[model samples]
Target chain A: MSVLEIKNISKSFGTLDVIKDISFSVEKGQVVSVIGPSGSGKSTLLRCATMLEKVDSGYIAYGDNIMVSNDAAGRAKYSDKATLNKIKLSTGLIFQNFNLFPHLSVLRNITEAPVCVLKKDKNEARQTALELLDKMGLSDKADSYPCQLSGGQQQRVSIARALALDPEILFFDEPTSALDPELTGEILKVIRTLAEDNMTMVIVTHEMAFARDVSDHVIFMDGGYIVEQGEPNEIINNPSSERMRTFLKRIIEK
Target chain B: MDYSELLKVTGILLQYLLPTLKIFGYTLAFSIPLGMVVAMLKMCRFKPVSWITNIYILIMRGTPLMLQIITIYYAIPMIQTGGSDFFGGLFSGFDTRSDTYQFTALLIAFVLNYAAYFAEIFRGGIEAIAKGQHEAAFTLGFTKTQTFFRIILPQVVKRVLPASSNEVITLVKDTSLANVIAYAEIFRKAKEQMVFYSSLAPLFIAGVFYFVMNAVLTVVFNFIEKKLDYYQ
Candidate 1:
């Protein structure tokens, strides 16, 4: 089953063509990792798929609900408010900087959306939040604020926050890019656990080795288009394109 | 100054304390919320609305408060002509001819003037929040209103505390400017008593009242800051 389908999507920031007619689909419980150099439109593609940015001309659907599609005039028109909201409720996005609400405690941060947005019972939400925290190994830091926690711990809390909503799909924009090399492993490990639990996810990442190890599929994007994409081992190990060879060589040298 | 004279002076000045604080309390009560409205208006995306708010802020902040108070009290009546039934009916309830009109005029000027300053401070606090906070909240399915009140406002309150305290303290001292309109607040009473007693001691006693009020404010603001320290 296709969890998300983005077809013929193109986006531009003013005159700069950031994403040019990119298309992809994520299957149920499949982890798709998008790997590319800087300014390759990977982030923009993720943003467009997540509805943070609108495509110039394309279609995006979550399950069978179309969130955005073209009109007769060729302008992108979003779904009506109620349907758009339903689509939003079904997906989650985690940022690189771990944009946790600083004024809230770890427990409140996780439970807030569940109680407020989903209208879950207060006790039920708190119980779920406690369980998520325990799973994240942050049970002891429930009362602590984001500023009080280290970067890795904050990212874990953010992941827990996303899970509390029970979204069908989670999108990550460099989940571990902002952390120290030593701290990156913990976030990757958490994502690996989710993958093992058969969670559907689309990740734009720079961790080449982790992509090869954990991702079911790898997408290589450069200059606003997918240069190549296939099974993780096939894409990462056997380079068929000149640009992919140079890109991998540069990273390996670094 | 003799001890008995000191006590007598203190007694007289204390009688005017409530009236002085009335101006401070009322101005604060009205201005804080009005300032929030003004801040939103100033930040409106519509160019004309924000431009008008900008000019209002400019006029309030550029002119002296004393001039504004005097204009509100005196110039309003002078500007109203008998044939202008519209203006006459608008201010008909407010008899600018009455001696008590000074209090109303003083309040109008103080609120408008102080609200502008508070508006600017609030605008700064709102803008200081990082863009990522809004994005994170949006991704979590929070509406714009929910994101502002639930996520942004509490943090804004903490960030604006110190600057707001400074304005509040200034308002305490600015209340003495009411003496210019002969409203007979504490400082004006102290001045009259000084002349009567042939001593400067009454003036110094007036200082005591202001200092004590500001001291209490300092303590309250400090306590609030300490409470917010747990987060930052």
Candidate 2:
């Protein structure tokens, strides 16, 4: 069963059409990687999927309900607050910058959503947050603030924060882009673990090798559209389009 | 120029010092929260609420504090009564010279003046937070109000404290402005003593009182800044 579906989605900022008629789908428990050159609208596509940016026109369905659709005037209809809240509850997004609340302790950062948004019992939220932290190997830093932790540790905390809500699908927007090479390993390792657990994930990433290693399928985007997509091996080893071959050659040369 | 006379004036000034400090305390207690409300209103996306709050802050910050005190103490009753016989009868026994009236007028003026300044400090702090913070909070399913109180307000308070402390210290000195309305604060009492004695000693004594009060406030605010040192 498809967990998410996007049909003919488009997004424009003022006069610029950042995303033009992008369509994609993710099946249950499948890890899909979106790879593209800089300025290809990969991140914007992810943001639009999560309703962080209003789409110019599209239909996005999560499960059986339509989350976004164009009205009679051809303007995308956003979900109301109640429906948006429900959509957000089921979809978690991890940002590249971590964006942890600096004033909150690590444990509080992880448990905040569960306690506040999910309305879980305090003790239950704490236990779940602790479990997530432990899974990320960050249990010892629970009492520390974001400033006290390394960038890698903070990113792990952000992932734990997202996971605490127990969303069915997670969106990672270049999760390791802001990390140092050594730090990137830690975050990628955590994500690799999630993939092993069959967690449904849609990742917009620059880590080509990690995508090739862990993703069930890979998508190559260029010029605001999908240039090529297939199984990881098929796309990496036997890309059919000359554009894909040139893009892959350029990435490999660098 | 006997030293003992100067000492007597200083002793008299001390008697009124506590009451002045009480006014400062009450003004701060009221204005901090009030300033946050004003800041929120100014930042609100709703045009009418933001416009009204902006006008209020502008008028309060633009006008003279002394005039505001005069208007509250003297002009309010005139406007209410419109110089009618009923007005005279209603307030005939009321005395503006009473301690209650004096303190109330001073308190009102101080709160209004400082609330404007504090509101600006709050706005600056809130604006300092990166746009990414709100985006992150929104993606996490936080409502606008929850995002503000939980994530944004704490960070704003942290950033605003230094500027806020500066305003607070200035407020301690601004309390002297209350003397313009005959509030009998420490400065008022000290000036009265100087008029009778025809000496600079009373003014010097008043200076000491302000210095001492400001010094104490500096220490308290420093302690507060230290508690917020987690970010540093």
iRMSD values, candidates in order = 0.8, 1.2
Clashes of each: 0, 0
Chain B TM, per prediction: 0.94, 0.87
User: Which regions of candidate 2 fall more than 4 Å away from where they truly are?
Assistant: B1-4, B48-52, B71-74, B81-99
| Tens-digit lDDT string for candidate 1 (A151-242) | 99999999999999999999999999999999999999999999999999999999999999999999999999999999999988998998
Model 2, B199: alpha-carbon shift in Å? 2.0
Query: TM-scores of the first chain across all predictions?
Result: 0.99, 0.97
lDDT per residue as tens, model 2, A1-254: 58999988988789888888888899999999999888899999999988888888989988876789989988889777777788888898999898989999999998887888778999999999889999999989999999999999999999999898888899999999898899999999999999999899999998889989999999998878888888999998899998888878888998
Provide the lDDT at A9 for model 1.
83
List lDDT for all candidates, in order: 0.92, 0.87
Instruction: Score every model by TM-score.
Output: 0.97, 0.92
The 10-residue segment with the lowest total lDDT in model 1 chain B = B75-84
Candidate 1 per-residue lDDT over residues B144-228, each given as its tens digit? 9999999998999999899999999999999999998899889999999899989999999999999999999999999999999
Task: Give model 2's docking category.
Answer: medium
Q: How accurate locally is residue A193 in candidate 2, as Cα lDDT from 0 to 100?
A: 98
The DockQ figures for the candidates are 0.80, 0.65
Q: Which run of 10 residues does model 2 chain B get worst, by summed lDDT?
A: B90-99
